[model samples]
Target: MHGTVFPPIEPSEVISTFFFIVLLFGSFMTVVIANRFIPAVINVSFVKGYSVICLFIAIWEMISFSELVNPVLLPPASRVASMLVFLWSIGFLQSQIYATLYKLAYAFSLALASGVTLGVMISYYSNVFSFIESFATAARVIPAPAWLALSILWFGIGSASAIFIIWLGCFFPIFLNTVAGVAKVEPVQVETIKTFGGDKWDVLLDVVLPTAYHHILTGSRIGLGIGWITVVTAELASPDAGGGLGWMIMDSRVLLDITSVLCGVSAIGFLGVVTDSLLNSLEELVQTWG
Candidate 1:
C-alpha cells in the first residue's frame, strides 16, 4: 500500500498564513513604536516582555508545523489564527464575550455592594463580627468550584448559576480585606472625629471608609480576578445554558480542535489583562484623591 500523502496547500491557506504573519508584524511594530515614542506613557518593560513571548510562541508554532512537534496534539499558531478569524467572522465569538462579561459585571457588582456593607457592619459591631467571622473564615477556605454543585442545584444551569459561582468566588476576598482595613483605622483618627462632635455615622463615613478605600480597592482587584476564573469554570461546567469562551473551549476539546481551545484561552487571558489594567488605573486615581 502507498504511504498516505498530504495534499498541497491551497492559495487561500497561503493567503491566510500571510495575513497572520502581517498581523504579528503589525503588533510587534506597534509595541516598538510605543516603546520608542511613548516610553513615559506606557509600561515599556511589560510591552517588551509581551512582544518577546509572542515572538517565541510564533516561532514555536512554525517549528511545530514543520513536523518537529505533533501538530495533531498541539495545533500550529496559523491554525489558531485562522480559527480566531473564523469565529470572529461568524459573530459567535463576540456574543460569547458579551455573555461572559455581562455575568461578570453583575456578579462583581453584587459582591462589591454586599461585601463592603457587611464588612463595615462587621467592623463596627463586635457582636456582628463575632457571629460572622468564623463563618466567613470557613467560606473563604472553600474553593469556588466546591460550591458549583450546590449552585447548580439551586440556580440550575444558566446565568444564575454562573453569577452565583462568581459572587461566591469574589465575596470573601472583598469582605476580609475591608474588615482588615477598617480594623486598622487609627483609634486617634476616630477619637479626633468624635471630639469634633461627630457621631458614629459621621465617623464611619468620614474616617473609616476613606481609610479603608485602598484596602477595598485591593480586595476588588483580587475579587475581579477570582470572578473571571469562576465564570469560566461555571461556563465550562454548564456550556449548554449560555455559550461562552469556556463553552467554546469545551467544544473544541471534545472535537480535538486544539487550535480553537488555544484561541479561547488567549481570549480569556487578554480580557483578564485588560480588566486588571483598568482596575489598576482606577485604583491609582482613588489613591491620588485620598
Candidate 2:
C-alpha cells in the first residue's frame, strides 16, 4: 500500500508523494487558504468555486467505482495516489518526467526560433503571407500521426524526429500568431516614430516588437501546448522512444498497467498546465502598453 505499488516505488518517497498531492490541488486550494486567511477579501465567492468541482469529481469517482465500474479501466483515485507515492520513492517519477521535459524543451526552442522568423516574414510580406496561410491551414488540419510517419521517414526514429514532429505540430499556430501580433502594431506609433526620425529597424525594435510581444508570447504559449501533444505522437512513431513519460505510458498500456498510465497522464497534464499558467502570468507582467 506504500510506495511499492508503483514500478518499484518505495516508502521513502512518501513525502514527495504528499507534496505532489498538495501541488495538484494547490491552485484551487489557494482559494480556500486565502478566504480563511486573508482579510478584506472581496472576490471570496470565486475563491472556493473550483473546490466544488474538485469535490464533485471525487464523489463522482467514488460512486463510479461503487457502481462497479471496472477498476482496471478506471482505477480508484486512492489506488492511483498510492501508486504515485510508490513511484515517487523509486526514482521512477523523476526519470520519466525528465525524459518528456527534455524532448519538449528541444522542440519548443526550435519552434520559437523558426516560428517567429517565419511569422515575421509572412506578416511583413504579402506574397509570403498568402503562401504561408495555406500552409498553416494544412498543418493544423493534418493529423499529428501523419506527421509522425513523415518525421520518422525524414529524420529517422529518435529525438531529432520527435523534435521535428513536435515543431510541426506547434510551428504553424505560433507563426500565424507572430504575424498577427506584428501586423497589429499601430500605424500611428510607426508614424510618430518616423516623424521623430526613427528608422525601420528602430520602429521594429522599439515599437513593433514591443507592441507585438504579448501576441508573440501568446503564440509561444500555444506552441508549448502543441509541443506537449506531439510528444505522445512522437513516442508512438519514435525509433528510440522507450524510457520517457510518453514511452512509459505506451509501455504501461501495452502491459495493461492502468495505474501507471494514470500517473503518466497526470504528470504530463500537470506539467503542461503549470508551464502554460506561468507563461500566461509572465505575458501579463511584461505587457507594457496594455
**lDDT per residue (tens digit) for residues 17-39 in model 1:** 45666778888788888878878
lDDT of each: 0.83, 0.73
Model 1 alpha-carbon drift over 4 Å, by segment: 1-19
Count backbone overlaps in model 2.
Answer: 4
Deviation in angstroms for 107 in model 2? 1.2
* TM-scores for candidates 1 onward, in order: 0.89, 0.79
Count of backbone clashes, every candidate in sequence = 0, 4
Residue 88 deviation, candidate 1, in Å?
A: 1.3
Between which residue pairs do clashes occur in model 2? 3-9, 3-86, 9-86, 157-239
**For residue 238, what is the lDDT in candidate 2?**
55
- The alpha-carbon root-mean-square deviation between model 2 and the true structure, to one decimal in Å, is 5.0
